[model samples]
Target: MYLLGLGLVLLLMKYLEVDPVATWSWWVVLAPFAAAAAWWAWADATGYTKRRAMEKMELKKKQRIDKQRESLGLKPGKRR
Candidate 1:
């Protein structure tokens, strides 16, 4: 994510003709994009992406359930 943001910022700076970035070679300025791509590829291959998505979904489900229980005046259950 950081690499992706950096890549985008560098791209914008170059396009805007900002000094330092504008003077940098295209390869240097765009390296972060390649890095970001490689990092994402590695995360996907290792199931890190799936794990994170599942965790997020689980959290959302828990939140929804809690809201329902609260509306129904039910006691809280065990925390994970």
Candidate 2:
């Protein structure tokens, strides 16, 4: 995400002819986007993406359960 943001900023700077960035090659300005793509590919291949998504779902589920329990005057379950 940081790489993507950097790539966009560099692109804008280059487009606006902002000093050193304007003098840099398009490849240099665009490298962060390529890096971001590589990072995403690597994350997907390593199951990191899936694990994060599953964790998010689990958190949401636990929160929903806790909210229900609270509404019924019950205590929230202990965290693992």
Candidate 3:
């Protein structure tokens, strides 16, 4: 998506016969930093990374429970 935006920007500059280096100096300087910050903000806001971490933790917990049940010679879904 960012690449698409950059391609469009370049195409527009070409079509307009503008010196992109001059016209887009600020963008060149700022776009990458802005993109990185936006990505970080979105990740933080959506808690996607946090959710993944939680999922891993849950899986580990389930594995440990299964191991304990096996050690007890008990089958899952059976009340003892």
Candidate 4:
């Protein structure tokens, strides 16, 4: 995320012909995008994305079930 934002800033700086970025090669302006691609590829290969999604889904489901239990005047219990 930081890389992408930095890349956008660099792109804007280069486009507006700012001093340091203006002299930088296209590769410099584009490196963040490449890094992001590589990062995403690595995440997919390691199942990081799916694991995060599943964890989020589990959290949401737990919250929902807890709410239901609360509405029924029951206490939520811890689950391992």
Winning candidate number (lDDT): 2
Selected candidate, larger lDDT, 1 vs 2: 2
TM-score of 3: 0.48
- Which is the better candidate, 1 or 3, if ranked by TM-score? 1
User: TM-score-based ranking, best first?
Assistant: 2, 4, 1, 3
Model 4 lDDT, residue 10, Cα: 92
The C-alpha local distance difference test score for the whole of candidate 4 amounts to: 0.91
Clashing pairs in 4: none
Model 2 is weakest, by summed lDDT over 10 consecutive residues, at 71-80
Encode model 2's per-residue lDDT on 1-80: one tens digit a residue.
99999999999999999999999999999999999999999999999999999999999999999999899888899555
Q: Model 3, 1-80: lDDT tens per residue?
A: 57456756665665576874445655664465567677768878999779989999999998888889989998854665
- Could you tell me the lDDT of residue 16 within candidate 4? 100
Q: After superposition, how far is residue 63 of candidate 1 from its true place, in Å?
A: 1.3
Worst 10-residue lDDT window for candidate 4 reads 71-80
Q: Where is model 4 more than 4 Å wrong at Cα?
A: 78-80
Better of 2 and 4 by lDDT: 2
lDDT of each: 0.94, 0.97, 0.71, 0.91
Per-residue CA lDDT of model 4 for 1-80, tens digit only, reads 78788889999999999999999999989999889888889999999999999999999999999999889888886556
Cα-based lDDT at residue 78, candidate 4: 50
Candidate 1 structure quality by residue, lDDT tens digits, 1-80: 99999999999999999998999999999999999999999999999999999999999999899888888898656455
- Rank order by lDDT, top first? 2, 1, 4, 3
Q: Candidate 2 at residue 7, lDDT?
A: 99
